[model samples]
Target: MTVLPNNLVFRSITGPEELELFNRLPYVQNDELADDLARGRRRPSWMWMALDGDRLLARLSWWCRPQDDAPFLLDLIDVDDSAHDVDRCAVAEQLLRTANAALFPDGVPVAQGTPPPEFLRFVPADWRADESTRRMVEDRVRAVERSGAVPLVERLRYEWFAGYPVPRPSDRLRFRGIESTEDILGLMARALDGTLDAHDRLDLQERSAEEVAAANFADEFANYDTPRTWWRVATLPDGEPVGFVIPARNAYHPIIAYIAVLPEHRGHGYIDDLLAEGTRVLAEEGVPNIRAATDVGNVPMAKAFERAGYDTISAVVNLTWEK
Candidate 1:
């Protein structure tokens, strides 16, 4: 029961019975909503909307793993496009503030995912240059910023379809499954020394590089619902490790979860071979597509992905509120 301007009422969907009302928002597709509900990644109480009486004006929703009681991210927030720019920003800001207070009283970090290029086909060809679309996007981003969130990183999402050509593996490096968690951690420590991953770099500001790398490894490992046998380490002919790649299935698709070259071995162009091996592993699995992401600023990694024949599918802007 939060108060608002324009005689709007702010609240979560009443229950499963009000799902239609929740899904009726212009931004969400009914089929996608239904799929998420069936998978337990979304719940009625996780969707909060600002309504002008019975008319929906704004909405915010959080997503989480099926087994988790708390949400891991705030992925969706939308305001009515028909509203004035100032009003739209105000409504969205208010909705987010109220939703944050109710859904995350303990002040957990908030994370969001942006759709990739493939998903933006419905948008106009020049949407990025279009004034209205640009303003709307900026307004929403500003509203989120007003709520104490900051853009954490910009990542380029890449996809390798089944028929795409995966580069032939270079015999210069040998690929093998990870031996043990300790061994992998030791490699991760070395990988962090000259890491270009934005999230990893940002984390180094607050924690020791090793601690940040370890925490990242743990967080990623917890998300894999698939076998860890897909993980591979690349080494020289003499068996000294050069780098590693983790090819695993996430909640949605098979992904190159983590790939890194040791700081000492970096400039030798071994990353291309490592990436090819990871893609070859997933391609052999016959998955429709293998998805991967790298920080936009990480030109070497981005180049490796392109050379491996992965298409740039989308760009993701991750905004985070840390406490």
Candidate 2:
């Protein structure tokens, strides 16, 4: 094989060790991102690059599956916002070329190959707020367009960090973990009321709430990396159920797998009790961080997450085809 050089260059590096440098770059969610890649849930195509002497920037990441000759995912197209001297377009092109070589199913490059991999470039809506960021995104989008793929999915990435004091135990609400399967299914049915989210709506495909609960359990709950025993359900002293939270780790990150308050329970501060109890469970386990997200349009629940100290890491906008 022949190696090449450039005046302003970027190239691919194999294995986790070389990848670590890019992964550690500022603003990269290193550990959590690595967890996604390692699990085969996300893969970087070439781990693309840009350089001018010791100064460097990243342009795009392509996650592909060689078996299907498919481009599966793309993300983390970030850079040091202050470093605006380099040619953003050229950097995007060069980095994408690296992805072609390293990720092409037959070891071919995009320039001489079937075409560029179609991918999703995630950015906080503020990406184009400045020249460098805008240029970087523009060039990448143009490159993909030129390569015969569409700039398909656009999403928002949210974040929260720094210190958040745990809520003081509320006098009106007390919490405890659920113990038996029967109780879990019971609460889940009540929580189902007034739910408009897509995942919950999937419950309609089944004949009963128990069936709905079972399907949700297998697809989501059964796959968690954290203990189910940590899940909590909230209730009133008169034995009425209000809300619940299931804190667990999935393939992506540690998360609140499920949190809902019955429709009748909405507007009251019952959500605060549920959020605190859920977050407290993870905090008590000493997990350094947890990741969770909901529909951007779900205003109140989103607010609840912020109050409970969850910074939105990213927004997943879904697309589907059906009958």
Candidate 3:
């Protein structure tokens, strides 16, 4: 454990039994901590805390694919809001710096390059208009910034309840179950062209579209245990491929994992058809909720979700150490 000047000590939780102590500053992931730990998506060593005596002042945790041994996302970070005199942001920054060094001593992971794990924080949809909420979020952002991470993207998160009206499938295009993984890979690579997604665009800077598509497939799309038959490719009546959608239940919720209109098929409102098909598939499965996200700047996607009866429930900001 590292001791700080203000009698604060930083260290990882001793074990799953210490989760209650770590949950002092509540967040959305509180309920999943136990399951995540048991399922191997989280490890005690990846969960760190900065404590003032017996009080939990700040906490940071990373999550990863259950089958993978390395951290995939730095998803949870929080500081006690009620601790009036504490420099909470500073505490968070220090905790992040210490944990990151211990987590990535070699400065890189073999699968993902430098700063493999990116920080993701969920905030209220109108966080900026709410002073307390804004402060709570911005403080964490500033702390991560202080630890050498830069804001990469801010995405609008949406949710669709079972009762929400899903659009009728398009008459212009027909949807079919994915024929094979190679087919989806080909379309994913093609969709990267003219992509407005912040994450995809960032990756395209250093990697080819095919390489990025393959990486996404291996790291995410292929990892979900949900039925692969739920994936669909939308093709024109003439049998020309337009786009595709993957509706799958991830570790948490049933989600429209991906939807895209091919570069050549853009400007025809085909995205709506793709999204609707994805939502319809999940709703038919009797899922209570379906969730999806798109970059805040991707107006077309945001509008499509709104038109399809999905509500903007929150926003997620992703930050990463400068590569």
Find the candidate with the highest TM-score and give its number.
3
Q: What TM-score would candidate 1 get against the native?
A: 0.87
For all candidates in order, the CA lDDT equals: 0.76, 0.61, 0.90
Clashing residue pairs in candidate 2 are 45-62, 158-312, 160-311
Q: What is the lDDT of residue 289 in candidate 3?
A: 98
**Model 1 Cα lDDT, one tens digit per residue, 200-304:** 887788899779868877777656877778888999999999999899998778899999999889899999998988888888888999999888789999999
Tens-place lDDT per residue, model 3, 133-200, is 99999999999988778889999999999887867777999988888889999999999999999899
lDDT rank, highest first?
Answer: 3, 1, 2
Candidate 1 has an lDDT of 0.76
Off by over 4 Å in 1: 1-5, 25-31, 106-127
Cand. 2 Cα-lDDT: 0.61
Error of 1 at 121 (Å): 16
Candidate 3 deviant stretches above 4 angstroms: 1-5, 108-113
Comparing candidate 1 with candidate 3, which one achieves the higher TM-score? 3
**Model 3 lDDT vs. the true structure?**
0.90
- What does the lDDT read for residue 62 in candidate 2? 51
